[model samples]
Target: MKALIIGATGATGKDLVHQLLNDKDFEEVDIFVRKPIDVQNDKLKTHIVDFEKPEEWKNLVKGDVAFSCLGTTLKTAGSKEAQRKVDYDYQYEFAKAAKENNVDDYILVSAYGADPKSRIFYSKMKGELEEAVKQLHFTKITIFNPGMLERKDSDRTGEVLGSRIIKFANKIGLLESQKPLPTDILAKAMINSSKIKSNGYSNIKLGNIFCFAEKSND
Candidate 1:
Protein backbone atom coordinates (compact mmCIF):
# COMPACT_ATOMS: atom_id res chain seq x y z
CA MET A 1 0.00 0.00 0.00
CA LYS A 2 1.10 3.56 -0.62
CA ALA A 3 0.84 5.88 2.36
CA LEU A 4 0.96 9.67 2.24
CA ILE A 5 1.49 11.84 5.28
CA ILE A 6 1.45 15.54 6.25
CA GLY A 7 2.99 16.87 9.45
CA ALA A 8 5.69 14.21 9.28
CA THR A 9 7.91 16.39 11.46
CA GLY A 10 5.55 16.32 14.44
CA ALA A 11 5.81 13.84 17.31
CA THR A 12 2.80 11.80 16.23
CA GLY A 13 3.71 12.16 12.56
CA LYS A 14 7.29 11.04 13.20
CA ASP A 15 6.07 7.92 14.96
CA LEU A 16 3.56 7.28 12.18
CA VAL A 17 6.31 7.57 9.54
CA HIS A 18 8.56 5.16 11.45
CA GLN A 19 5.77 2.63 11.81
CA LEU A 20 4.73 2.94 8.19
CA LEU A 21 8.26 2.44 6.95
CA ASN A 22 8.60 -0.74 9.02
CA ASP A 23 5.13 -2.14 8.29
CA LYS A 24 5.11 -4.96 5.75
CA ASP A 25 1.79 -3.80 4.29
CA PHE A 26 3.10 -0.46 3.10
CA GLU A 27 5.49 -0.45 0.16
CA GLU A 28 5.79 3.32 -0.19
CA VAL A 29 5.70 5.96 2.53
CA ASP A 30 5.57 9.55 1.27
CA ILE A 31 5.94 12.45 3.65
CA PHE A 32 5.13 16.08 2.79
CA VAL A 33 7.10 18.54 4.87
CA ARG A 34 8.21 22.18 4.77
CA LYS A 35 11.83 21.16 5.35
CA PRO A 36 13.93 18.05 4.71
CA ILE A 37 14.03 15.33 7.37
CA ASP A 38 17.22 13.37 8.24
CA VAL A 39 15.75 9.86 8.09
CA GLN A 40 16.73 7.66 5.17
CA ASN A 41 14.85 4.54 4.11
CA ASP A 42 14.26 2.75 0.79
CA LYS A 43 10.47 2.87 1.31
CA LEU A 44 10.43 6.56 2.27
CA LYS A 45 9.82 9.47 -0.15
CA THR A 46 10.10 12.92 1.33
CA HIS A 47 8.62 15.92 -0.48
CA ILE A 48 9.60 19.40 0.65
CA VAL A 49 6.58 21.57 -0.11
CA ASP A 50 5.02 24.93 0.50
CA PHE A 51 1.67 24.10 2.04
CA GLU A 52 0.18 27.39 0.93
CA LYS A 53 0.57 26.38 -2.72
CA PRO A 54 -1.40 23.18 -3.07
CA GLU A 55 -1.50 23.28 -6.86
CA GLU A 56 2.23 22.69 -7.07
CA TRP A 57 2.14 19.55 -4.88
CA LYS A 58 -1.45 18.37 -5.17
CA ASN A 59 -0.54 15.78 -7.76
CA LEU A 60 1.80 14.07 -5.32
CA VAL A 61 -1.01 13.43 -2.82
CA LYS A 62 -2.07 10.27 -4.65
CA GLY A 63 -1.80 7.20 -2.41
CA ASP A 64 -3.89 4.41 -0.90
CA VAL A 65 -4.39 6.33 2.33
CA ALA A 66 -3.45 9.83 3.55
CA PHE A 67 -2.72 10.78 7.12
CA SER A 68 -3.32 14.32 8.32
CA CYS A 69 -1.85 15.17 11.73
CA LEU A 70 -0.55 18.65 10.97
CA GLY A 71 -1.06 21.20 13.70
CA THR A 72 0.51 24.15 15.54
CA THR A 73 0.14 25.58 19.02
CA LEU A 74 -1.03 29.17 19.47
CA LYS A 75 2.20 30.08 21.22
CA THR A 76 4.32 28.64 18.46
CA ALA A 77 2.25 30.28 15.75
CA GLY A 78 2.31 33.64 17.59
CA SER A 79 -1.29 34.43 16.57
CA LYS A 80 -4.64 32.79 16.00
CA GLU A 81 -4.54 33.51 12.27
CA ALA A 82 -1.11 31.92 11.85
CA GLN A 83 -2.14 28.95 13.96
CA ARG A 84 -5.24 28.48 11.83
CA LYS A 85 -3.15 28.61 8.67
CA VAL A 86 -1.14 25.63 9.86
CA ASP A 87 -3.82 23.79 11.86
CA TYR A 88 -6.67 24.33 9.44
CA ASP A 89 -5.77 25.72 6.00
CA TYR A 90 -2.73 23.55 5.27
CA GLN A 91 -4.44 20.38 6.49
CA TYR A 92 -7.69 21.11 4.71
CA GLU A 93 -5.81 21.79 1.49
CA PHE A 94 -4.01 18.47 1.77
CA ALA A 95 -7.28 16.63 2.40
CA LYS A 96 -8.79 18.37 -0.60
CA ALA A 97 -5.89 17.34 -2.80
CA ALA A 98 -6.10 13.76 -1.58
CA LYS A 99 -9.79 13.60 -2.42
CA GLU A 100 -9.19 15.22 -5.77
CA ASN A 101 -6.54 12.63 -6.56
CA ASN A 102 -8.95 9.81 -5.59
CA VAL A 103 -7.33 8.66 -2.35
CA ASP A 104 -10.01 6.41 -0.90
CA ASP A 105 -9.06 6.47 2.79
CA TYR A 106 -8.02 9.27 5.13
CA ILE A 107 -7.02 9.18 8.79
CA LEU A 108 -6.96 12.37 10.84
CA VAL A 109 -5.67 13.13 14.31
CA SER A 110 -8.08 15.49 15.99
CA ALA A 111 -8.38 16.74 19.55
CA TYR A 112 -10.65 15.73 22.40
CA GLY A 113 -13.81 17.81 22.98
CA ALA A 114 -13.82 18.93 19.35
CA ASP A 115 -17.24 20.32 18.50
CA PRO A 116 -18.42 22.68 15.79
CA LYS A 117 -20.30 24.64 18.39
CA SER A 118 -17.33 24.80 20.77
CA ARG A 119 -16.76 28.20 22.33
CA ILE A 120 -13.06 27.65 22.89
CA PHE A 121 -10.94 28.89 20.00
CA TYR A 122 -8.72 25.82 19.72
CA SER A 123 -11.57 23.36 20.09
CA LYS A 124 -13.68 25.31 17.63
CA MET A 125 -10.86 25.33 15.08
CA LYS A 126 -10.33 21.60 15.37
CA GLY A 127 -14.07 20.97 15.16
CA GLU A 128 -14.31 23.13 12.07
CA LEU A 129 -11.47 21.18 10.40
CA GLU A 130 -13.17 17.88 11.25
CA GLU A 131 -16.38 19.06 9.64
CA ALA A 132 -14.56 20.38 6.59
CA VAL A 133 -12.77 17.11 5.91
CA LYS A 134 -15.92 15.04 6.44
CA GLN A 135 -17.57 16.99 3.66
CA LEU A 136 -14.86 15.83 1.21
CA HIS A 137 -16.36 12.33 1.58
CA PHE A 138 -13.53 9.84 1.46
CA THR A 139 -14.56 6.16 1.11
CA LYS A 140 -13.24 5.59 4.65
CA ILE A 141 -12.52 8.36 7.16
CA THR A 142 -11.22 7.68 10.64
CA ILE A 143 -10.80 10.57 13.05
CA PHE A 144 -8.91 9.84 16.23
CA ASN A 145 -9.44 12.29 19.07
CA PRO A 146 -6.76 11.90 21.71
CA GLY A 147 -6.44 13.88 24.92
CA MET A 148 -3.15 15.05 26.48
CA LEU A 149 -0.68 13.31 24.19
CA GLU A 150 2.55 12.18 25.90
CA ARG A 151 5.37 13.18 23.57
CA LYS A 152 8.93 11.94 24.03
CA ASP A 153 11.43 14.43 25.42
CA SER A 154 8.92 17.21 24.98
CA ASP A 155 10.17 20.79 25.28
CA ARG A 156 6.76 22.27 26.05
CA THR A 157 6.92 22.89 29.82
CA GLY A 158 3.15 23.05 30.19
CA GLU A 159 2.60 19.77 28.32
CA VAL A 160 5.34 17.91 30.19
CA LEU A 161 4.09 19.20 33.55
CA GLY A 162 0.50 18.40 32.64
CA SER A 163 1.48 14.86 31.61
CA ARG A 164 3.30 14.32 34.91
CA ILE A 165 0.29 15.57 36.84
CA ILE A 166 -2.04 13.34 34.86
CA LYS A 167 0.25 10.33 35.42
CA PHE A 168 0.19 10.96 39.17
CA ALA A 169 -3.60 11.19 39.09
CA ASN A 170 -3.76 7.97 37.07
CA LYS A 171 -1.58 6.24 39.67
CA ILE A 172 -4.25 7.14 42.25
CA GLY A 173 -6.98 5.63 40.01
CA LEU A 174 -8.19 9.05 39.02
CA LEU A 175 -8.74 10.50 35.51
CA GLU A 176 -8.08 7.20 33.79
CA SER A 177 -10.18 8.30 30.86
CA GLN A 178 -7.98 11.36 30.48
CA LYS A 179 -4.68 9.56 30.90
CA PRO A 180 -1.95 10.98 28.68
CA LEU A 181 -1.79 9.05 25.41
CA PRO A 182 1.59 8.16 23.96
CA THR A 183 2.28 9.27 20.36
CA ASP A 184 3.35 5.76 19.37
CA ILE A 185 0.05 4.32 20.57
CA LEU A 186 -1.86 6.85 18.55
CA ALA A 187 0.27 6.03 15.49
CA LYS A 188 -0.41 2.33 15.97
CA ALA A 189 -4.13 3.01 16.21
CA MET A 190 -4.07 5.07 13.03
CA ILE A 191 -2.31 2.25 11.15
CA ASN A 192 -4.74 -0.29 12.59
CA SER A 193 -7.68 1.82 11.50
CA SER A 194 -6.46 1.79 7.89
CA LYS A 195 -6.41 -2.02 7.83
CA ILE A 196 -10.05 -2.34 8.86
CA LYS A 197 -12.10 -3.49 5.81
CA SER A 198 -15.25 -1.65 6.72
CA ASN A 199 -15.71 1.80 5.24
CA GLY A 200 -17.41 5.12 6.14
CA TYR A 201 -16.81 7.57 8.97
CA SER A 202 -15.47 6.34 12.32
CA ASN A 203 -14.56 8.61 15.20
CA ILE A 204 -12.34 7.04 17.86
CA LYS A 205 -12.31 9.23 20.93
CA LEU A 206 -10.18 9.22 24.09
CA GLY A 207 -10.26 5.81 25.76
CA ASN A 208 -11.50 4.07 22.61
CA ILE A 209 -8.23 5.05 20.91
CA PHE A 210 -6.33 2.66 23.17
CA CYS A 211 -8.59 -0.20 22.08
CA PHE A 212 -7.97 0.59 18.44
CA ALA A 213 -4.22 0.31 19.00
CA GLU A 214 -4.60 -3.25 20.27
CA LYS A 215 -7.04 -4.25 17.51
CA SER A 216 -5.88 -7.05 15.21
CA ASN A 217 -5.96 -6.28 11.51
CA ASP A 218 -6.71 -9.92 10.69
Candidate 2:
Protein backbone atom coordinates (compact mmCIF):
# COMPACT_ATOMS: atom_id res chain seq x y z
CA MET A 1 0.00 0.00 0.00
CA LYS A 2 1.07 3.56 -0.66
CA ALA A 3 0.34 6.15 2.07
CA LEU A 4 0.00 9.88 1.75
CA ILE A 5 0.41 11.95 4.93
CA ILE A 6 -0.04 15.60 5.78
CA GLY A 7 1.30 17.25 8.97
CA ALA A 8 4.15 14.75 8.98
CA THR A 9 6.17 17.23 11.01
CA GLY A 10 3.85 16.96 14.03
CA ALA A 11 4.45 14.45 16.81
CA THR A 12 1.75 11.90 15.92
CA GLY A 13 2.39 12.44 12.24
CA LYS A 14 6.17 11.97 12.61
CA ASP A 15 5.62 8.68 14.39
CA LEU A 16 3.11 7.67 11.72
CA VAL A 17 5.65 8.35 8.98
CA HIS A 18 8.29 6.27 10.75
CA GLN A 19 5.94 3.33 11.26
CA LEU A 20 4.70 3.43 7.67
CA LEU A 21 8.25 3.38 6.35
CA ASN A 22 9.08 0.30 8.43
CA ASP A 23 5.77 -1.51 7.91
CA LYS A 24 5.94 -4.22 5.23
CA ASP A 25 2.39 -3.39 4.18
CA PHE A 26 3.32 0.03 2.85
CA GLU A 27 5.66 0.29 -0.13
CA GLU A 28 5.78 4.06 -0.23
CA VAL A 29 5.07 6.96 2.20
CA ASP A 30 4.57 10.44 0.85
CA ILE A 31 4.62 13.40 3.24
CA PHE A 32 3.47 16.90 2.30
CA VAL A 33 5.04 19.73 4.29
CA ARG A 34 5.63 23.43 3.93
CA LYS A 35 9.44 23.07 3.96
CA PRO A 36 11.88 20.32 3.01
CA ILE A 37 13.09 17.97 5.71
CA ASP A 38 16.58 16.49 6.03
CA VAL A 39 15.48 12.92 6.72
CA GLN A 40 16.00 10.50 3.86
CA ASN A 41 14.50 7.05 3.27
CA ASP A 42 14.13 4.81 0.24
CA LYS A 43 10.34 4.56 0.59
CA LEU A 44 9.74 8.13 1.68
CA LYS A 45 8.73 10.95 -0.68
CA THR A 46 8.71 14.41 0.87
CA HIS A 47 6.80 17.11 -0.98
CA ILE A 48 7.39 20.71 0.09
CA VAL A 49 4.13 22.51 -0.49
CA ASP A 50 2.19 25.66 0.33
CA PHE A 51 -1.10 24.84 2.02
CA GLU A 52 -2.72 27.98 0.64
CA LYS A 53 -1.90 26.94 -2.90
CA PRO A 54 -3.36 23.46 -3.18
CA GLU A 55 -3.48 23.67 -6.96
CA GLU A 56 0.31 23.55 -7.10
CA TRP A 57 0.57 20.18 -5.31
CA LYS A 58 -2.84 18.53 -5.24
CA ASN A 59 -1.94 16.02 -7.97
CA LEU A 60 0.72 14.41 -5.79
CA VAL A 61 -1.92 13.51 -3.18
CA LYS A 62 -2.68 10.28 -5.01
CA GLY A 63 -2.08 7.11 -3.00
CA ASP A 64 -3.88 4.07 -1.60
CA VAL A 65 -4.67 5.84 1.69
CA ALA A 66 -4.31 9.37 3.02
CA PHE A 67 -3.69 10.30 6.64
CA SER A 68 -4.77 13.77 7.66
CA CYS A 69 -3.31 15.03 10.97
CA LEU A 70 -2.54 18.63 10.19
CA GLY A 71 -3.67 21.14 12.84
CA THR A 72 -2.60 24.09 14.98
CA THR A 73 -3.40 25.50 18.43
CA LEU A 74 -4.91 28.93 18.84
CA LYS A 75 -1.81 29.97 20.76
CA THR A 76 0.48 28.90 17.93
CA ALA A 77 -1.86 30.15 15.20
CA GLY A 78 -2.38 33.52 17.02
CA SER A 79 -6.11 33.64 16.23
CA LYS A 80 -9.16 31.51 15.53
CA GLU A 81 -9.03 32.44 11.88
CA ALA A 82 -5.40 31.43 11.52
CA GLN A 83 -5.98 28.21 13.42
CA ARG A 84 -8.97 27.41 11.22
CA LYS A 85 -6.89 28.03 8.15
CA VAL A 86 -4.46 25.36 9.24
CA ASP A 87 -6.77 23.01 11.13
CA TYR A 88 -9.71 23.22 8.73
CA ASP A 89 -8.96 24.81 5.37
CA TYR A 90 -5.62 23.14 4.73
CA GLN A 91 -6.79 19.73 5.89
CA TYR A 92 -10.05 19.97 3.95
CA GLU A 93 -8.17 20.94 0.79
CA PHE A 94 -5.88 17.93 1.13
CA ALA A 95 -8.81 15.61 1.76
CA LYS A 96 -10.62 17.03 -1.25
CA ALA A 97 -7.60 16.52 -3.45
CA ALA A 98 -7.09 12.97 -2.18
CA LYS A 99 -10.68 12.03 -2.97
CA GLU A 100 -10.41 13.64 -6.37
CA ASN A 101 -7.33 11.53 -7.03
CA ASN A 102 -9.38 8.40 -6.24
CA VAL A 103 -7.67 7.56 -2.95
CA ASP A 104 -10.21 5.17 -1.48
CA ASP A 105 -9.06 4.97 2.13
CA TYR A 106 -8.71 7.94 4.47
CA ILE A 107 -7.61 7.99 8.11
CA LEU A 108 -8.09 11.18 10.13
CA VAL A 109 -6.83 12.14 13.60
CA SER A 110 -9.80 13.96 15.06
CA ALA A 111 -10.52 15.08 18.63
CA TYR A 112 -12.89 13.75 21.23
CA GLY A 113 -16.16 15.67 21.80
CA ALA A 114 -16.24 16.68 18.17
CA ASP A 115 -19.74 17.66 17.03
CA PRO A 116 -21.00 19.95 14.31
CA LYS A 117 -23.42 21.47 16.79
CA SER A 118 -20.78 21.76 19.50
CA ARG A 119 -20.73 25.08 21.34
CA ILE A 120 -16.98 24.80 21.79
CA PHE A 121 -15.02 26.40 18.99
CA TYR A 122 -12.34 23.73 18.64
CA SER A 123 -14.77 20.85 18.75
CA LYS A 124 -17.09 22.56 16.30
CA MET A 125 -14.27 23.07 13.82
CA LYS A 126 -13.14 19.48 14.10
CA GLY A 127 -16.72 18.24 13.81
CA GLU A 128 -17.33 20.36 10.72
CA LEU A 129 -14.19 18.99 9.11
CA GLU A 130 -15.25 15.45 9.90
CA GLU A 131 -18.62 16.04 8.27
CA ALA A 132 -17.08 17.62 5.18
CA VAL A 133 -14.71 14.72 4.65
CA LYS A 134 -17.42 12.15 5.24
CA GLN A 135 -19.35 13.73 2.41
CA LEU A 136 -16.38 12.95 0.13
CA HIS A 137 -17.41 9.27 0.25
CA PHE A 138 -14.10 7.48 0.77
CA THR A 139 -14.25 3.67 0.57
CA LYS A 140 -12.93 3.40 4.14
CA ILE A 141 -12.77 6.13 6.76
CA THR A 142 -11.29 5.92 10.26
CA ILE A 143 -11.49 8.83 12.65
CA PHE A 144 -9.39 8.66 15.80
CA ASN A 145 -10.68 10.79 18.65
CA PRO A 146 -7.90 10.63 21.14
CA GLY A 147 -7.95 12.68 24.33
CA MET A 148 -5.00 14.59 25.81
CA LEU A 149 -1.87 13.42 24.01
CA GLU A 150 1.44 12.86 25.78
CA ARG A 151 3.98 14.24 23.34
CA LYS A 152 7.72 13.66 23.60
CA ASP A 153 9.66 16.59 24.98
CA SER A 154 6.52 18.64 24.92
CA ASP A 155 6.91 22.34 25.60
CA ARG A 156 3.35 22.90 26.70
CA THR A 157 3.46 23.16 30.47
CA GLY A 158 -0.25 22.48 30.90
CA GLU A 159 -0.09 19.33 28.81
CA VAL A 160 2.88 18.05 30.76
CA LEU A 161 1.24 18.78 34.13
CA GLY A 162 -2.07 17.33 33.00
CA SER A 163 -0.37 14.13 31.85
CA ARG A 164 1.37 13.78 35.21
CA ILE A 165 -1.89 14.26 37.03
CA ILE A 166 -3.58 11.69 34.85
CA LYS A 167 -0.74 9.27 35.40
CA PHE A 168 -1.02 9.69 39.14
CA ALA A 169 -4.73 9.14 39.02
CA ASN A 170 -4.30 6.07 36.84
CA LYS A 171 -1.97 4.57 39.44
CA ILE A 172 -4.84 4.79 41.91
CA GLY A 173 -7.20 3.14 39.39
CA LEU A 174 -8.89 6.39 38.60
CA LEU A 175 -9.72 8.05 35.29
CA GLU A 176 -8.05 5.30 33.29
CA SER A 177 -10.43 6.10 30.48
CA GLN A 178 -8.92 9.59 30.30
CA LYS A 179 -5.34 8.47 30.52
CA PRO A 180 -3.34 10.66 28.21
CA LEU A 181 -2.41 8.85 25.01
CA PRO A 182 1.14 8.90 23.71
CA THR A 183 1.65 10.16 20.17
CA ASP A 184 3.49 7.03 19.02
CA ILE A 185 0.67 4.86 20.33
CA LEU A 186 -1.88 6.90 18.40
CA ALA A 187 0.29 6.52 15.30
CA LYS A 188 0.35 2.78 15.81
CA ALA A 189 -3.43 2.70 16.02
CA MET A 190 -3.74 4.65 12.77
CA ILE A 191 -1.50 2.23 10.90
CA ASN A 192 -3.23 -0.80 12.39
CA SER A 193 -6.70 0.50 11.52
CA SER A 194 -5.60 0.91 7.90
CA LYS A 195 -4.62 -2.76 7.83
CA ILE A 196 -8.09 -3.85 8.94
CA LYS A 197 -10.28 -4.83 5.95
CA SER A 198 -13.38 -2.93 7.00
CA ASN A 199 -15.86 -0.78 5.17
CA GLY A 200 -17.73 2.42 6.16
CA TYR A 201 -16.72 4.75 8.99
CA SER A 202 -15.26 3.85 12.40
CA ASN A 203 -14.91 6.47 15.12
CA ILE A 204 -12.19 5.28 17.49
CA LYS A 205 -12.69 7.25 20.67
CA LEU A 206 -10.68 7.63 23.92
CA GLY A 207 -10.97 4.22 25.52
CA ASN A 208 -11.09 2.58 22.10
CA ILE A 209 -7.87 4.32 21.15
CA PHE A 210 -6.16 2.52 24.01
CA CYS A 211 -7.55 -0.75 22.73
CA PHE A 212 -6.21 -0.15 19.24
CA ALA A 213 -2.85 0.95 20.64
CA GLU A 214 -2.60 -2.26 22.64
CA LYS A 215 -3.40 -4.24 19.50
CA SER A 216 -0.41 -2.59 17.90
CA ASN A 217 1.73 -4.69 20.23
CA ASP A 218 0.01 -7.86 19.08
TM-score of each: 0.93, 0.92
- TM-score of model 1 (CA atoms): 0.93
Q: Please identify model 1 stretches exceeding 4 Å from their true place.
A: 200-218
lDDT of 2 at 195: 85
lDDT of 1 by residue, 1-218 (tens): 99999999999999999999999999999999999998999999999999989999999999999999999899999999999999999999999999999998888888888878999999999999988988887777788788899999999999999999999999999998889989998998889888987743344454635221121122
In terms of TM-score, the best-performing candidate is 1
Q: Could you give candidate 2's per-residue lDDT for residues 1-218 as a string of tens digits? A: 99999999998988998899999999999999998766789999999998989999999999998999887899999999999999999999999999899887788888877889999999999999988887777777777878889899999888899999999999999988888888998898888888887544334454535221111111
lDDT of each: 0.88, 0.85
As for model 1, its CA RMSD to the true structure in angstroms is 4.0
The 10-residue segment of model 1 with minimum total lDDT is 209-218
What is the model-wide C-alpha lDDT for candidate 2? 0.85
